[model samples]
Target: MSLPDDTRYLKGGPVAKRIMAEVARDAAKATAEGFPPKLVSITVGDVEAVGVYVRNQRAKAEQAGIGFEERNFPADLTAAELEAAIHGMNADPRVTGIIIQRPVPRHIPIKAIQAAVHPLKDVEGMHPASIGNIVYNELDLAPCTAAASVELLKETGLDLKGLEVVVVGHSEIVGKPIAFLLMSEGATVTVCHHMTRSVAAHARRADALFVAVGKPRLIKADMVKPGAAVIDIGINTETGPDGKERIVGDVDTDSVKEVASWITPVPGGVGPITVSILLRNTMVALARQRALYQATYGTAE
Candidate 1:
């Protein structure tokens, strides 16, 4: 979708690059200090879409100077076996973080695997404790997408304090964490779900809006407040008149850009920043491990 001339396109390239540079520096330091940050990604079965995501993550990890490993298990692997493997990674001091790729065989419970990853080594921040930390305003290890969305909102240069924010979708990982994260920043956030009687009413009053309901073009221009910053976290595939599949965000970027001051493009927006945040979480986990090491051994190494 073509962006309007007057609207600021919230491209994520610059933000991801700036974060990667810092992570690279710290990654180098962590390596030199005998605590290299290594992320172990577990994938069950052969899923084409998940493969694409795994490759992107590995490339970003390489750019950030972090070690990445992909462990592909058989589709028949049981949940207990997967959890045991995750526990093994948790015990390895060289392993800094663990990421459980989504859509495992229907037999395997994804959340159980996520919980199996140690809280300290849960780089994806899907662990219950990792998500719970956001409630206390400790955002160091928040879910990558939620953290990335908040980071993009900050890039818009809007003062978060008392900002009227409306988040559509209340999923455990994305929507709930986003509301808590924004509230911690002092923004008055209203979350909309399937039960919300008037999603548009709350959305139109928002100074900053976040949408992640997985529905394409769910937020039209009329639903947005003028000059508000819109963060589109939903990634959906839609077939156009040409009979080809295309990616579009939850907000109709082509239409909403005319009214909104800033809007995030689907492919170039939150996805890239989300990957960068994952790498950043890896470093955060490494730092926490390093600090514990220092406290125990009286030396960083």
Candidate 2:
């Protein structure tokens, strides 16, 4: 049976642009007072997709009036080099926030690199300290994409409290943190992984479902509960009939849209919001630092 065409799409790009513009205004005020906000992104290797993502992030940071720095390492660089890069950014006073793009070189140890970044500057929220803050429900900056997921839901005017939310995938960046954020918002969250027994069963019972397994078309129509809100965070590329590749998300959008009450389309949805959240985090960091500075000194002229 064909699913119902009752889906509500959440467009994130325009919302992100608007939010960043606000941040830019605030940043301008701070800079006029002699304190400038800055963000640095560290990337290893030259993976095409990762490069594109980082470039977009840098562009957004610049447009937001946040200082942007790019630190590039060779593909064959050792883990120690990556750690050094993080340490350098951590020590740089000009850098208010730092982000390390994922899918680092296979030979590099991500855990070690993540540990080297100072918790304050780890704007991507991948550090253990940041995760601990999340676990303890502290007022620390959350992982950007995870926070963006919550923002997307709220922007849709949906109430999250007491909802049955199911998240597929167990990645530290998107899956686990998002579950924590949803739970913190008072939603009953169930986290499923690649090996979960009957993952579809769990998904079918959700009031809201977020999928980020990085597999194209992983979440099918039947697996989604009727009227459930589905957020697809995966971006996978596959070769088309003409030998070119196209980007696709976890949900079978065409079919799932019929069943879901609300959904996020891949290209226009989560990607933009995630970048927006990163800028927001940078703004937050800058504001806090500015406040501390003002308290130490006197108000600017």
Candidate 3:
């Protein structure tokens, strides 16, 4: 079967605009009530991509009227030092949300450092508590990337319930969490990894597919099911002859787009939504904290 011409390509800019508008509205409400929303991000290393991502997030936060702060450390910092930084952010009342950028120095135990961040302030939803909440089907923050993937699919007017969904990759940050979230939404979920046998066979059966294996052009046209919704979370780069690197996603966009009914492009797709979802989580955290504060101290006049 050929791809449907009505297939929609999900764009992040409009969704980001909507999120920023909501944040502005909520910030106004918070300010009128005598409180201000804030988000804090902690980075341990000098990874260029991570730095660019943090800057983008800070820009988004500022646009949404939320205070943004970046705490950076040398790449050589020890795990203990990273944990300490997270602990400090956890204790800061003004900081409603905290995200410790990933791929921290190899020496650092990321899980231990993540656990150090207060679960309530873990806006990126990498904390164990957030994962537990997700498993239990409770209303809690999810890793922004995973949540953004689901939201992007939903916004396409597709119903996930009872769909055969295949997720390629098993990283805690994206793959596994997204499969869990999809299962929660009533989709039949399959989780695959690099070692998985007949990966293409699995993908070809998917009514919906999410690829986050971080390999460029990993999913070719033959592996995709016609009319399926494909979400490409992979961002891989290769240096060109001119000594400049170009970014591309796991699926061969030109080819896959011809087979899939709906797809998300690399730079313009999940990335923007991921950052927007971070802002959304921060706003949610702020609203929850504000409600609790008012319940204890009475609403501000």
Specify the highest-TM-score model's number.
1
| Cα error of candidate 2 at position 151, Å | 1.8
lDDT per residue as tens, model 3, 7-35? 77876777777877887888878867777
* Clashing residue pairs in candidate 1 (N, C-alpha, C atoms within 3 angstroms): none
Q: Which runs of model 3 end up more than 4 angstroms from their true locations?
A: 1-4, 45-49, 74-78, 239-244, 294-301
lDDT at residue 52 of model 3 (Cα atoms): 78
Cα error of candidate 3 at position 238, Å? 2.4
Q: Which stretches of candidate 2 lie over 4 Å from their true place?
A: 1-5, 44-49, 73-82, 102-107, 241-243, 291-301
Q: Give me candidate 1's TM-score against the actual structure.
A: 0.96
The CA-based lDDT of model 1 is what?
0.91
Q: Model 3 TM-score?
A: 0.89
Which pairs, if any, clash in model 3?
none
Clashes of each: 0, 0, 0
Error of 2 at 203 (Å): 1.1
Q: Per-candidate TM vs. native?
A: 0.96, 0.88, 0.89
Clashes of 1: 0
Local distance difference test, per candidate? 0.91, 0.83, 0.84
